[model samples]
Target: MQSCRNCPCTSRSRARTATARTQRSSRSCVTSTRAGSSYRWTILAAGVVAQASFSAILLGLPAIAPQIRHGYGLTLTQVGVVLAALNVGLFVTLLPWGIVADRIGERAVLATGLTGCAAALVVAGFTSSFGGLVAALAAAGALGGGTQSASGRAVMSWFGPEERGLALGIRQTAVPLGGAIAAGALPALSAHISLRAAFFGLAAGCVAAAAIGTALLRSETTKADEHEDASPPLRNPRVWLLCAAGTFYVTTQISLIGFLVLFLHDDRGVSTAASAGVLAGTQVLGGAARIVVGRWSDRIRARIVPLRQLALALAVAAGASALLVHASLWLLVPALAVAGTLGLSWNGLSFTAAAEAAGRRRSGAAIGLQQTFLSGGGIVAPIAFAAIVHATSWRLGFALAAASPLFGYALLSPLAERRS
Candidate 1:
């Protein structure tokens, strides 16, 4: 193996490439040593940037949903279809990408997946018809989904367990950064340029991410990091419980945060900018939650207590918000903001719980199963809400949102007892 002394602060991607060449020649499994490696930290920074790009694809289109609806003369179902297209990309591709990440190592999978997102987002930007849009979104989602699982795995490998929450929290910050950026900026971008241009901008950003990812994504010391694993059966009870809890947490999250702006505009009759501000603010609030919750998870022995407290708090917030659906247009800002704050912030904690529940050896698959459950909610909830909006109104739809957390709480409550 080439000494770290030679490259100085060489990029992990280059390191990986060099290691692979060395292994082929020597028929050995030695990974690049981390001696004198300042560049490893740069990889983490790049991972953060890549995550932001991935998040933009998920949230950018929704920011311009109103314009798209008007331009296309779309019905509620069609609007749902557009939103669903993005989530569908996320849902269907998440586990498959996880499997791939396990097989190839994170760097190769991350580079390929990001490039796919760039191409697909560009296609989505130009597509005119619904079918064309769907195809592009799915492709973007397939590529984009790989970032989360693979990135999380990469961070885990890069940093040891104690630094994990901080490292992972930095990675998780992409969720809010992407959402806040799209929510605040895309509408303005759409006003001056076309929505397509805004998408092109994101496409450009993702391309930049891909280039960095290609250079940074190499490291495969552990056997688990070298090969992808198939979908294994759930042998542990904690995995199943986490799956159930994660479903509820994500269901409440995706349904609310995903459509927070619409809920403000349609249900409360807020202005578009105000709605965007609310969306942006909600992301900021949730971003803080990821850091706070993640750090808290690190200090505490039992993450379940904090998570359960958060879940129960969310249930109360959601229930109260559900009641306030018809109070007045003015009440929604605080209601939705608080609801979003508690609703979506549980992810870091839950993911931390995944590491604890399944142990590090099986953590990737455990996380994949939880993510699959989370994404499954993305498929079902919006469709149901669309039906509700068509038949009645959003107030009833808001009332119905409580069901998932109630279910999530049922599963998550048990975690406190079983926490290691």
Candidate 2:
């Protein structure tokens, strides 16, 4: 009845009521995303833990190689085979894991994979037979391979383009950090306690990493932009080139990691504990190198150029280490340190270039593809280096391994002309 002139009270009341409703809706929609929202550092931490889980079995083996070999009476060739088995598992699973990460999301894939690895390692710890132990390790590698793609993908998604290189560099440090920890702990455990206990300790680490990954990993819900959505990373030629370079680089790196302790202890007559300590120091320096290179790449805004230079540097270092292997610790230590630093430092730079080239949406799949090549190299490097060592000497084997990075440097030099 009070339709027009007398409706001031009604209008004001409706306006106030609408304003209150808006405020309530806003509050209701404000979900606590702080915990779930992706931070560059948080993603980096998750990536490190996931990467560490993957490295523990492989990297730790070199530290405890003598104990395991003596315990099982395994030949150097057989030891090499066992090492290759883990890479075999990684090579088989990388691409599939990448596809899964692209489809189901990185969080689920990493959590599920790391959890499975924990179980596999537990089985490995209890197994008495060397064959059984190798099988379990291979299985664990397959299960844990998802982290390679999933963690990198998470970093690519969370960080901006300019910062991804440095972010990934920091994330990549987990691999060496894991190696350092394993180097420090595994040899002591295998020597003092038992091989089984060492494996169980590694299993426990994977379990903790899985729990952390599940809690911290965030899933991407928004659609990607045009570049990321248009072409699959596998279709990009840049990715293939990066993968090619990575394969050679990984070959050289795995050889150094796999055989450094043995070379030190056998050739230079260093104690096992001292040799493991040196390898651990190398991993620490390598980790530092990654961060420095990554930051430098960010500063220059060029990835491939630095990668080429690093490859060349690695070649020189490897060659020098080969020549200096039988020398005194004063010479050998610095040579190995330089070689390890340059050899292990290339991954972050190449990975950043590959991921950027693949675009964000397809980064998981691309990283998986590239990692497959790297894993393939890992499979071959150990066996090949062992065979060469058996046929000739550790010096010759390292000399030969140096050629790989030289080739990688040659292959990647052309990329410097193009944008990274």
Candidate 3:
């Protein structure tokens, strides 16, 4: 056989092989980059679904308060207690869950917690006594608390600073979206079948979300990096200030979300279905507003500035709703929708601020601490608002609720000025 080492044909064939290999390598690199870019969005979708699922239990339970009260033959105060039970559970567990997420991983925390929450909701569905129902719901809240920190930490790890605001905003929409789903479905389900059916429906959602989140979520950090030293969220005054602002903001949110249906139904004589429809509409609007505000924050490259502005707007809108309480249904509905949308819009900004303040490694803890304050507000708002309504009137109660966002705005001013 002739030696062909330097043959011209052989040279051409070798060159062809090299070019083909280069092309294949380039294609693989592009494919990898595309997959990485797209996968973050998939992670975001999973987080949204997981949060929304749990929110159904947290916020949705209040939507069917009438059924719960009637079924248990409870007073408004007792109804407030029942509604607050879930927040009490959340308050107890949020920090611990956050610490756990920072140590382990988002996937494990979200999957395990959501599963436990589903089981707890099932227990709630089956329980017949008032005390048993409260206990079951609180258990669900405690377990579901993991979703808040883990899902947020996942977003912070996966997305860069430039995109974090919009990403968190979209993620935050899960709250109103979940509430809307619950408000729209639970009342009708309870009215037609039973309140137990409502609880079962929420359980089904949690189970489905757990499965989806488990399949999609993963920790973006290495074991060592995840445990890296960062500013302690507890010691950070900025974080505490953010927490205080969030606490006040949530009171307004709960006042509208937890009681709007009741107010319209009892005070205005609107049918339960109609009142729930308004609430559902408000939630949808709020979700859309979050997306818009999030994008706006990204454009401005500032979170607290817009947050403070929105707080003022929320205060005004809420006050307007209070004033319009006895106005025509057409007038009152639109005003409440604006206020509710404003109330729901600021959360994503605060979430982004808290995570950035703590650095990515400790984002979970910061978010947890912030959410814990908000949960405390969630616990108190219903009871206080209910008491105010019981003692004086719904109009006065709503007027007072409007002041919460103003307090939040004031708390956020120093932060906003520093950012400016």
What is the lDDT, from 0 to 100, of the residue 232 in candidate 3?
A: 87
Considering TM-score, which of the candidate structures 1 and 2 is the better prediction for this target?
Answer: 2
Q: What is the C-alpha lDDT of each candidate?
A: 0.72, 0.85, 0.88
lDDT of 2 by residue, 68-111 (tens): 77778888988888878878889999999998998889989998
Mark the regions of model 2 whose C-alpha exceeds 4 Å error after superposition.
1-38, 221-229, 418-420
Answer with 2 or 3, whichever has the higher TM-score: 3
Residue pairs clashing in model 1 are 102-227, 102-228, 103-227, 103-228
Model 3 TM: 0.90
Which residue runs of candidate 3 sit more than 4 Å off their true CA positions? 1-36, 222-229, 417-420
Clashes of each: 4, 0, 0
TM-score of 2: 0.89
Q: Top model by TM-score, which number?
A: 3
**Model 1 agreement with the true structure over 187-237: per-residue lDDT tens digits:** 888888887887788888788887888877766354433453323526777
Off by over 4 Å in 1: 1-41, 220-234, 328-330, 359-362, 417-420
Q: What lDDT tens digits, residue by residue, belong to model 3 across residues 1-420?
A: 356968889989999999999987766543432344678888899999999999877777777877788899988988998999989999999999998998898999999999999899889989988899889988989999999999999987777667788999999999899999998999988988988889889989988999998999976643334455697899999999999999889899889878988888888998888888888888889988888998898888888899889888988999999999999999999999999899888898899999988987899999999999999998999999999999998889889989988888888888884632
Per-candidate TM-score against the hidden true structure: 0.84, 0.89, 0.90
Pull out the clashing pairs in model 3: none
